[model samples]
Target: MPKMKTKSSAKKRFKVSATGKVIGSQAGKQHGMIKRSNKFLRNARGTTALSAPDAKIIKGFMPYDR
Candidate 1:
């Protein structure tokens, strides 16, 4: 059988944590910073874990991540 390939886009955007959770970056921080409060920007820093239902779908795209 041929080897299953991981989705390049998913690989770049999502990460599999040590505990098997799918990690992803926060949204709404890419642009329009002028209107956003300073506290919102400060709190948005760093990645966050995806919900189980959502992560399960994303995980399908990462075939070789295991």
Candidate 2:
């Protein structure tokens, strides 16, 4: 059987943590930010874990992570 390939886009956007959680950056921080609130900007500064269902889907693409 052929090897299953990882999804390039998913690989770039998502990361599998040491404990097997999928961590990802918050959106809306990539574009213009001057109009956004200070609190909004601050909150978007770190990675957040994906939900259970989304994490399952992300794990498929990050097979090497586990």
Among these predictions, the greatest TM-score belongs to 1
- Residue-by-residue lDDT tens digits, candidate 1, 1-66: 998888889999999998999999988898999999999999889999999999999889998665
Shift in Å, residue 43, candidate 2? 0.9
lDDT of 2 by residue, 1-66 (tens): 777788899999998888989999988998889899999999889899989998999899867777
Candidate 2: Cα lDDT at 64: 74
How far does residue 28 in candidate 2 sit from its true spot (Å)? 1.8
Worst lDDT 10-window in candidate 1: 57-66
User: What's each prediction's TM-score?
Assistant: 0.88, 0.80
Model 2 compared with the native: what TM-score? 0.80
Query: What is the lDDT, from 0 to 100, of the residue 42 in candidate 1?
Result: 90
Clashing pairs in 2: none
Question: Model 2: runs farther than 4 Å from truth?
Answer: none
List the candidate 1 regions with Cα displacement exceeding 4 Å: none
Report the error of model 2 at residue 30, Å: 2.0
